[model samples]
Target: MSFALYLAIMMTGDQIELVQESFAHVLPAAAGAAHTFYDRLFTLAPETRALFRGDIDDQGRKLFLTLAAVVDALDQLEKVVPVARALAIRHVGYGVEERHYSIVGVALIETLRGALGVRFNPETEAAWTSAYAILSGVMMSAANETASVKHVVAA
Candidate 1:
């Protein structure tokens, strides 16, 4: 199914609204949260750290921007999913594995909780979880399909 359609089926409008609102509130702290997310990701999966060799500050900013874009585009995910898939394809060159997505999600949630403080309530957390799952699932599926095509081309 299309990522947008799948997400509509999997998530309620309330869930999407909660996540978007919570993320907007947390936007000011996005840079710090992004940094925290990367730090936690490195701590959780050290092997993935080497994939980043450039300036971390820029990378963090980019991550936050990308995340914000995704959150903002939840209602029009068809437009965003292609960009996410492109990102997945790029990450393949950076040696990103499928397992890293889950670790990144965990780190992202922890970062949001830390940054948002008491604002990250149960309902908000659930919404964020659903959003992350849908986004990550789309990225991973696209990455896998791209890899398969690459492998076939190589063979």
Candidate 2:
């Protein structure tokens, strides 16, 4: 999809349906989707794979379990974002670069489409893409802002 089309959807506010569709139609797929996603993610970024301890497949299951727990408590994003932000800061220790976000996004979308099967229509696809964009942008910005503040404090 063109950037123009993405912007048009945002401008027209037609995406609320998409968002609702996600919370309704897609939430069930999230756990399986995330497991598959991290599999491909680790495969593509083998160096980062070492970040996981013990059995790789078990680690993937544990990951989806944690995310599912958080999704169940989505209303408590104050807790979620703080934990996420702290983990993002720790990504430095894992050698996760900002560029890895794109790879992660790709695996995520692929996993969603795979898990959703026939229900992953074009509109759903667009919505997922939009959601990922917003997620990635926010996460990267937060990480960057934290990094800047830390830099200033250290200096």
Candidate 3:
């Protein structure tokens, strides 16, 4: 399944609503959720831990804050594209490869499941999955473009 087709099929008004609503539930425990997300990410991809330099807690906070902003802008996704692109470019500098996105997505879903518990139903999971897919897709595309440009310049 191509990313474009997946986005077209999975990202709908109802799914957006589900993601927004489910994320609202995560806000109260956002700190914990962030911690869980990082923990899961490191566990899933231990090598990726080399990408972080400073405090894990601080990084987690930034993660949640970014996520909050992204969730708030879901209805206007275009508004976040530039920000995501810049972030992605920076991530490329941090040794983040394209495959790390999938590892991060799995960690995100697990974090949501742990945070939402019973509230994280199949529909909610699907919503968050779609949202992550869309966001990561944009980031990965931007990263790839940046890498290509750098390669061309280097060559």
Query: Which prediction has the highest TM-score against the true structure?
Result: 1
* Number of clashing residue pairs, candidate 2: 0
lDDT for 124 in candidate 3 is 94
lDDT of 1: 0.89
| Cand. 3 Cα-lDDT | 0.88
- For candidate 1, the clash count comes to 0
Q: Is candidate 1 or candidate 3 better by TM-score?
A: 1
Model 1: CA > 4 A from native: none
Clashing pairs in 2: none
Error at 140, model 3, angstroms: 0.4
lDDT of 1 by residue, 53-80 (tens): 8999999989988988998888888877
Clashes of 3: 0
lDDT of each: 0.89, 0.62, 0.88
Q: Which residue pairs of candidate 3 clash?
A: none
Candidate 2 lDDT: 0.62
lDDT of 2 by residue, 36-92 (tens): 887788788777676665676576666566545444433334444555566677665
lDDT of 2 at 24: 59
lDDT of 3 by residue, 1-155 (tens): 75445455557889888989999999999888888888899999999899999998899889988998988877776676777888999999999999999999999999999999999999999989889988898899999999999999999
